[model samples]
Target: MDFLENVVSKERTLNPEERVGEALRQAGVSITITSITDVFAFAIGATTRVPVLRSFCIYTTAGIFIVYVLTLIFMVPILSLDERRRDSGREGCLCLRLPADYKKNRCSQKLLLEVIFRRIFGPLLVKTPVKVVVVLLTMGLLGLNCWGLSGLKNDFDRTWFFNPGYQRDFVSAVQDLFPESGYRADFYLGNTDYFREKEALEELFNRLSALPGIKNGSIEFWHHSFLEYLKEKKGKPIRIMNVSTKAMQLTLTRRPPPMWICKQADILLNSVPPVGAMNHPGKISPGLQYMCANG
Candidate 1:
């Protein structure tokens, strides 16, 4: 309005409506489509592993929508005051091409975009056989992609963040030497009274035993073996040193060495007690040696 009134046509001034129409005819649609492409790029990039792009996309989308709505509402009036003669017979002139003779078949950017985006998809949507084939191909591709994704396992190797060969080889060597390997889970009892809450603990143990992915014989509780030992002790007195040990000593060097010294020697040597006819609890005591104290 300012240009037309002051500079271009001082005598015959152009109205606001005429100016808006002229602006739209010149570059509005092209600008709108370019903005749409930008928004699409932002949206798709947001879906990928890019946080800054996602934030920019969100702000850009909101800003674009707000300005677009405000412009449409305020500037695009229904009534027209100017009578500018249009050459093209097209109704919705959103292609944003320059006004020219419609008879010429010369291709423009707008026509090329229309042909690729609209005309190409239009036949695929309307035609039955093409639509069916496209849908089947799409479904097959989706399924194959899902299957491939399912095969991707989560890898958290420490070497991934460090120098690959050196750190990885060092770890592998350590594992090979002192190969301490086991699956263990710890449960904090806090200040709970274990004797008073035996039933709850038993229930918890049963639940843990029933859990999936737990090896059949892997679950171990201190109380389980302790209770079994108590049960066996209650049945009969457990012989600390059997007659065979004394007999073997008599056969070799008699005099019957002190029981305390014998026990210390046996423990230091990690002596495996022979399985006798009497099912003694001493045989199972080695497995009961745990790092965590039940009390």
Candidate 2:
């Protein structure tokens, strides 16, 4: 082992791991090379069995499949950047960013491959070009996947969640009657006696909500987005309004509807504390719940 290490370690520019890899070549035996994508794919695929791994399956089959694929289209640039770095013969950004003494910097992908071969040694297959080709092919396949995703029949109608059957039909009929009136906002009104009385809360909540980026506000002339007020409303009457964007049936045809001007969006109620109960809106954080309940 020292003989091999001594042979490889003599290379001035090659990283230590790269040196070890060269030593392995002298010894013979190859292993398969893994790329960033392979790492991610395995990382994602493994998540199915290991619940912890699933945290990385960002590419879920949600809402619009085609759009999701299109979104993953961004992976192309990232992979390309990796390829460019590998070809330039410079250490990766990670290596450069690390403090000079970081061992991992010297243990580059190539060097690591060699070291593995020296230990378990089989001829290490899959080189830089192969990895790049694999990544490009995968991205292309993913792009084509967008077509199938786009074909998915998604009911993006605004009325469905709250009003189900007749509400859907009513919304459909309304669309026929006035295609321009498709936009709607939902305000989950929590009946708190506070807003009507707390002048400061009312004024602050109202003024900010009217501001852009804020979907809803509590009081008129106050600038508070509906989300901002969510934490503040603690057991108080809260009004959360959901705003609609242009993607609705017709952009200009719809406008933000005042409560009286339009039928308000549905009311979501939280009858219990946010954790543990079936009626709770948020999932129970078992870890936090344990610490809080027992501690």
TM per candidate comes to: 0.29, 0.23
Using TM-score as the measure, the top candidate is: 1
Q: Per-residue alpha-carbon lDDT of model 1 for 139-254, expressed as tens digits?
A: 99999999999999954333344566877787667556745432234454434433444456556666666656445656555434433444464586433222244233232233
lDDT of 2 by residue, 87-175 (tens): 35556656344444545534343556656887554433356776787799999999999988999894444443445677788767866
Per-structure clash totals for the candidates = 0, 22
**What is the alpha-carbon lDDT for the whole of candidate 1?**
0.48
Candidate 1 wrong stretches, greater than 4 Å: 1-112, 118-182, 210-212, 236-295
Candidate 1 local lDDT, residue 199 = 57
Consecutive 10-residue window with the lowest summed lDDT within model 2: 284-293
RMSD after CA superposition, every candidate: 18.3, 21.6
In model 1, pairs of residues that clash are none
